[model samples]
Target: MDSQMNAPWSNCSIGYSCVKLFPPPMHTVPHSGEAQHRTSPGVEGRGRMKRGVQHRSNGRSARKTRPGSESGFEVAHDFGPAAESARHFDPARRGYTWGMIRFTLLSFLLAALLLAALTGCSRMRFVVDLVPADDGLTETVVHEDDDARWRSPKVALIDVTGLIADVRRPGLLTRGVNPVAEYVESLRRAEDDSRVKAIIVRINSPGGTVTASDVVYRETVRFRERSGKPVVVLMGDVAASGGYYLACAADRIVAHPTTVTGSIGVIMQTFNFSEGMRRIGIHADAIVSGEKKAAGSPFEPMEPEHRALLQNMVNEFYDNFITTVTTNRTGLSDEQINTITDGRVVTGRQAHELGLIDEVGDLYTAFDTAKELAGLPAARLVKYHRALQHVGSAYAESPTGSSSTQLNLMQLNLDGAAMHDQPNFFYLWDPTIFSAVR
Candidate 1:
């Protein structure tokens, strides 16, 4: 008996019955208003008892207990199916339930009525696109503020805005319009129209490439000679450099009082990154066939010979520009032409005073001047634009619109990379480009 009490297990002998010991079963009494359920004799029942004991040990119960009862069973309140159904059908809630139903029914009925009305129409039409498909150029009549005749003998208003490049000015996603091509097309249209007795070339640009500017100038001169129609240039906000170069082709130049005209010179821009590369311990190993083959290369220092060569070319182009100005502006003497042709920009009033422009006035003054030049008593004003382009008034923006001349480092363009790779000659007047280095 002593061994049996001290040992881990009682010794079994002949004629002696062995019994297994086990912990007493736990019973959780159900709370008031809840049905009693049997607890399974396994891990699940133990888990529940452990949770109840944990709640009691924490000085709290899972639910409210009767006064003096220690059971931690959760109270089953009136949240069952029957209680939910009774609450849903209560008099206080009936109005809200019925209102929701009525609203649903009304919405369905209204939707059906709308569908029926649409089906009863003669045609089922849907507007998928607002822009017209036709992209052809169309003539738009621009009514002037004054009493100008609305019928032909017409004055064709052609706009030359933005960079006057022969190449297309590409956008972020669009294959943009070519200023030269658009100008030529408009000129062709005016030439073909017999009723168009005169042309008013409205210029708003700081200039562009030398070749492009010359192309527009040559075309305008040819158009005037071939069509026998007088061409009058009306300078807008800015018509400088190549803008002024093209204006030289006009029979008479009319600039507004505030217009910025005449930057009559050429510019070839390039940068040298040799010093920067050297500071960073990098060098360009370019193998060229001749000594001057890599002339004006940014990878290396520009030699004195290279500088002279570039300067000679610039002087040649400058002479051509000066000759064009003098030939067209016959009223101005050599001294007067020399004074303003030093790549300086002047206002319209100053330009007129300097004999660079014919008159200082508004669009009306240009109209009167055009009429006088064409020898017409009265003429209608018309503009050529794409079919879908809106032209509500005389000052409506052109299709090839003007862009800010400020240099933007973040702005992306399709041709930007290619344009930067090659050296370009510009007649542009944007001083903001140098700000990047500063």
Candidate 2:
């Protein structure tokens, strides 16, 4: 057969295409909910619906409703026979309910134990965490040890770390617990509650605003005078400045042997960054309403007279601190007090020798001291640790938050480790006490 005869005819038809393509037929169908606006028949005025504007019904009720929005009978009648199987005992839904049932049963079992607790099962003790707040934020950490015997419910461990404005400090203030106010209230509660035999204030602070310190100080003083409750103070790492101020409220203060205590002064610090700014050609144009208004501004050089005035203010606060301490620890000579308390960091032993602290011991010893001071029967030790809550501050702002968790002796968090560290106030160190030592 010839090649052309065997091949299809279309293969040789170069001028024409083999298959023909056609376009789809065009059509339009009416869609739901789209009604174009036009002038209503016979009505010339307000009857004409406006275009390019949303048509809202001014009628008292809805003119139309969607399937999902259908009301009354539609909701009841919509479900078919399929709903009958899924009503209650559907196998698909049983697992979740079964889990809930298990959880409820477990919870019920635990409830009896809690009921046992309510019925005076074990001597219930509350651990009141009173970590000082930083930047007005409290950082209180609670701990439970394996040796339950060491835990004391009667003893309230109030943390008075920084700025004793509230019961919440150094870390817990962020959660909104005020240590000072809490102290006053707790002391009152302890005084009234026959169950709370004694109170121990765990002082681990560098002090803060004088007003804040005074607020807590006044409470402690009131607690001692009015209640006559044995208020034993256990000094943490550094109970200097305002911390010591509050410790003065206690009948006896027991600090660790190496605990740094006794700043015994007030201080305020201001930074001068003008020189650094001038080096970078940065200038400050400050406008103020008063002459002394810009006194604390670091942009300008402080006037000599202004500096003298500020120093006088510091001196007054220092005098107040000295007077307060003298009233608490009477008979100590100026030289001796200055040597011990003159913004200097000293060991608990040194503080004891200097008559700053009454003894050197932990919270356990403080508890015993509290009983001794209270003159009560067999000092029952109780630990008060508050339940953890939404503490807002970060670790940087509140070091105690993280440090407090690790109560390990050798390897602990910074804040926990700080509990045994040295004195803390850099602003108050002066030539009188530290200069000779340096």
Candidate number with greatest lDDT: 1
Residue-level lDDT tens digits of model 2 in 1-438: 111121122122221122112111111111232332222244322222222222222211111223453321111011122233334444546678999999999997687578666654343323344875333222232322234233233444555544443334343223544555555655665666565556788876666556667777787888767766667888877777777887887878899997877777765455578888999999998898978877756678888877777778778878878878888887798789769656777889998989888988876677667766666545344333233323221111222331133334533223321222332222222222322222
State in Å the error of residue 100, model 1.
Answer: 28
TM-score between model 1 and native: 0.66
lDDT of 1 by residue, 12-39 (tens): 2211111123222333445443434344
List where candidate 2 sits over 4 angstroms from the true fold: 1-155, 162-176, 388-438
* Each prediction's TM-score versus the true structure: 0.66, 0.55
Query: What's the number of clashes in each of the models?
Result: 1, 35
